[model samples]
Target: MRLHEHQAKKVFKDFGISTPEGKVVNDPDDAEKIAEEINSPVVVKAQIQVGSRGKAGGIKFAEDPKDARKKAKEILGKKISGIKVKKVLVEEALNIEKEYYVGFTLDRGSGKPVAIISSRGGVDIEEVAEKTPESIAKEELDPIWPLHDFKARKLAFKGNIRKEAIQEVSRIAQTLYKIFTDKDATLAEINPLVLTEQNQLLAADAVLNIDNNALFKQPELAELREETEEDPLIRKAHEYGFDYVRLDGNVGVVGNGAGLVMTTLDLIDYFGGKPANFLDVGGGAGSATVENALDLVFQDPNVDVVLFNIFGGITKCDEVARGINEAIEGRELPVPLLVRLAGTNYKEGLKVLNDEKLRVVSDLEDAVKEVVKLAGE
Candidate 1:
């Protein structure tokens, strides 16, 4: 669950991290009013979840109230990275002396929360890593111990921050760590943490991605989720008790578990095919659940083929087969489907799907190759 810039800034404010004064407005008139109230050069930023808003022409500088309205009109209702910009964040622009990047996220390899600081800001961290790895500093926080001010200060020093700004940078780092842990966030970031002309630090931009599994405990954060930012199929999958993630590919993948689904996606790529989505029907999926999963996969127009890799343990293979046949009973499915059923009533399931039009391969590798071939056709 990714929070919009305004929502992330709200969370940052609660933790004593300063952000530029901004108001979220859906209307151009409201944006103009906010800019007039600020009475300074303001930035109109699209509120879409994806990045590169500036490159997409979703971000514009408004010299005054009238210009703000013009910029808002140009931004609103525009699509950035395929998401419609229904709202924009109008903020008082800052005069920055320098910019830095500060972020806290879980390091899966280390199995601990890691803090990353870089002198290079306003760009993707991955780019920094690829070009100038030494410009960034990283530290892993102990799970039992809180992120101490001293440790954050040390990290700032390591990042080669000037002595005058180290204290503010350290403070911001500590607050970011707090937000990451307290809110059950997978990522909390402030790109271009800027030093103003007055020598004050502020987060010019903010991003927070919460752990969906922890949303139950953080109702307030959960409420900040913008459903419009999500793919329709993903929302529909949630309603049907399945986990689905959309991807840019042509082959639709479905499996019984997360690990299996991930492996299937890799295999599709290895076979010179791209996966359209990751669909996990869970361990105990019934025929109805399988039908719903198939229906959801077919909803994606990019999907040229559907591949089912079911190593059923708790979910019987026959149930999955029945669901697939039932889903394609009357409707003419434009895309071909390939099924691989290896465990739990495999023979019975194979017998159930013995139709000549339906392609069934018992071997996983063979199934992937078949799907790749059919998708290409």
Candidate 2:
């Protein structure tokens, strides 16, 4: 779950982090009024979850109320990165002396949260890493120990920040760590954390991604999710009690576990084919889940073929075969289906699917190649 910029800023404000005062406006009239109230050069930023808003011309700097109104009018209802701008954040633009980046995210390989800070901000962090890797500073924090004040100070020092502002930076990092840990966030970031002309530090832009598994504890953050921007199939999968992710590809995949789904996706890619989605039926999945997975997969018009790679650990392969047959009984399934079922009731499952116009293979690699070939990859 990713919070909108305004929501992320609000969370930062709760932790005593300074952010620009702003009003969210959905209409031009409200925008004009807010701009007049601010009485300063304001920035109109699109209220969308996607990034690269600046590059998409979704952010505009206005010198006065009239300019703000005009920019707001131009931006409202405009589409940026495929998401319509329903509202704009009218904020007082700051005169920045320098920009920096600060973020807390999990380092998967180390199994701990890592703090990253860079003086080279206002640009993509990936670009900074590729061009000047030495400009960024990183520190890994143990989950059990958490981030300490001295460790934060050391990280700021490693970033080559001035001694005079080390305390301020450390304070901000500490607050961010608390926010990240307490909110069960997977990522919390402040890009272009600006040092104003008055030597005040403020977060110019903020983003926070909460851990989906921990949403029960953070109802307020969960409500900030943008459902319209999410893939419809994902929502459907959740309701149907399955793990699914929509991807941009031509082959549809269904499996019994995350590992199998991932391997299927990789093999599809390696065989010069792209997977349309990752559908993982849980360990105890029934026929209903299988039906739902097939329905979701067929909803994608780009899917030229469907692939079922099921290693029945808890679920019997025969039940999965029956569900597939049931799902395709009356449906206008235009594409071919390739199935590879192993483990429990293997022979029985083969018999259940033998009469259908399906290609069955026992070898995983051979099945993947055949599916790609059948899909004209």
Top model number, lDDT: 1
Candidate 1, residues 249-344, lDDT tens digits: the string is 799998999989999998888999989899999997889988998899988888999998899799899988999888888888778888899889
| TM-score of predicted structure 1 | 0.80
Query: How large is the C-alpha RMSD of every model relative to the true structure?
Result: 3.8, 4.6
For each candidate, the alpha-carbon lDDT, in order, equals 0.89, 0.85
Span of 10 residues, lowest total lDDT, candidate 1: 226-235
- Give the runs in model 2 whose Cα sits over 4 Å from its true position: 39-42, 49-75, 78-85, 93-99, 106-111, 119-140, 156-167, 195-200, 211-216, 219-233, 244-254, 263-279, 297-308, 333-377
Could you give candidate 2's per-residue lDDT for residues 1-377 as a string of tens digits? Answer: 77889989999999999999789999888888998998889999998876788988999999988899999999999876446788899999999988888899998768899998877878999888889877788988888876788898888887766677778888888899899999999999999889899999999999898989999999988887878854456667777877777666788899998888999999999989888888988786677778788888877777899998988879898998888788777766778888899998878888998445677888899989988887774
Name the TM-score of candidate 2: 0.74
